[model samples]
Target: MQRATVERVRVAWTRSTLDDRRAAGRALIRELTAELVPGADLRIEQRCPGCGGPHGRPMLPHAPVLASVAYAGPWAVVAVGSDRDVAALGIDAEQERAAPDLAALFPLTSPPDLRGWTAIEAALKADGRGLLLSPDQVRLSPDGRATVPDGGEFRILPVATAPGLIVTLALRHPDPGPRPTRRP
Candidate 1:
């Protein structure tokens, strides 16, 4: 995992198998629980408590960390951050070329428009507030940034790992500092 700082936020990414992903998710909950409450052992289940949603958004029995999970192809990405911070984190991995129609398999499609839709969904999950925003309410720019409607304060970054898969993460408290410039 690489932990870097864009502004003051600590960002990290890890590539793991399905089993490792589950374990890593558990570890994340444990670490966050330790930080929020001393001497408290938190056991997080990998299932959603709300209407058996396809994306299992786990809720902490007692904690202040907001987390989201997404599974793409064979990889599962889980992001955790402070509840008040509202950092939207998402990740998707796929083969370099096109494969079966994911949309047909799952109700959600991975078209370009899906990027903004995912970002809005992620932002809503991170905010843990009302369900006022819809997939149609957000728009993704050609450069891959998403602008939320209603002047909601958020930062949207869409990541393309391969040719066919896209993951969008939206953070309400995005760091405004200049992004790190990479040299070829």
Candidate 2:
């Protein structure tokens, strides 16, 4: 089975503006997909599953691949993989040392602290439901595995790319839906 891969690009965050970070994310997506799925006309689309609007998780329609993007502090991360390799993929990154109170709000999971939160968010992302699914519903193990209370299972990889930025990439359990049907 093929596997999804994630790449991160350092960002020059300015005044908490996300415009630059978002552009970097799209660029990362293009770079990752270039070698994986060559010659496919890729256009990132975000359609909220809840309301079918245009502001949701980023996706590459009709590209024979799955993609996800996340940003944390000065980093913009993107994950891309062939649709056949994994069901779905989601990524999330956060500044671990930047928030102690928020980190303490949730009990520690496998990776512990903010890393655990990223894993949970990654899983929720792969599920394509986002926060619509309660974080409490997801359970993570130290061995790179996550199980949602009644949803899809995922394999998670937690990485400490920078001194304080933690990024996690997750893949949903096999059986990606029929490609043509799902927009993602």
Candidate 3:
């Protein structure tokens, strides 16, 4: 990790113990990026959806690798794949029995809605649009595929992870094959 990243983690810890998870998510992204591109200068950019600040999705702007990192209760996940094969990638994990009650909590209205919500989140992250778009704008095909309102196909694949963790990986269609799933 870079000095800035390490210092950010320390500062987060000072704020609250729960913020440790965010730090872990950052560290995991660094480790995974290193593994994917060995010996190269790894520079990560956190592109903010709202203000373009240093607090959003972690992106390797220079490396020929595409990645997405997400964290939830008891889980922190990073998805790494060749930029050639994957133009965009997103991964999400949440407790099976957990659901946020916020109106913008991924648009969960029922049990079946969970998968759609997860799929939307993954797609949004992959599109680099984050939550800037309303969750209600996401449309899921009856065949279980998800599409952004403006129209672009995303394949949502169910990932088998630890028990009680509902994992989903989203990538723009025309993908070649599976990449890797790193957890911490």
Best by lDDT: 2
| Candidate maximizing TM-score | 2
TM-score of candidate 1 against the unseen true structure: 0.53
- Give candidate 2 regions above 4 Å deviation: 1-17, 51-53, 100-112, 173-184
lDDT of each: 0.50, 0.70, 0.64
State model 2's lDDT: 0.70
Distance from true location, Cα of 21 in model 3, Å: 1.8
lDDT of 3: 0.64
Error of 2 at 100 (Å): 7.0
TM per candidate comes to 0.53, 0.76, 0.75
Candidate 2, residue 30: Cα displacement in angstroms equals 1.5
lDDT of 1 by residue, 1-184 (tens): 4332332233334556866775665565466546655665465654434554433555565666555555555454455565555444432233334333334323454543355445656655544432444444555556545555654545666554434555556565645669889999
Arranged by lDDT with the best first, the candidates are: 2, 3, 1
Task: Please write out the lDDT profile of model 3 over residues 103-165, one tens digit for every residue.
Answer: 645445532456666777888887778788776667777775778876476777766556676
The list of candidate 1 runs beyond 4 A from truth reads 4-11, 32-41, 45-50, 53-55, 87-110, 113-137, 141-153, 158-167, 174-184
RMSD of each: 8.8, 7.9, 10.0
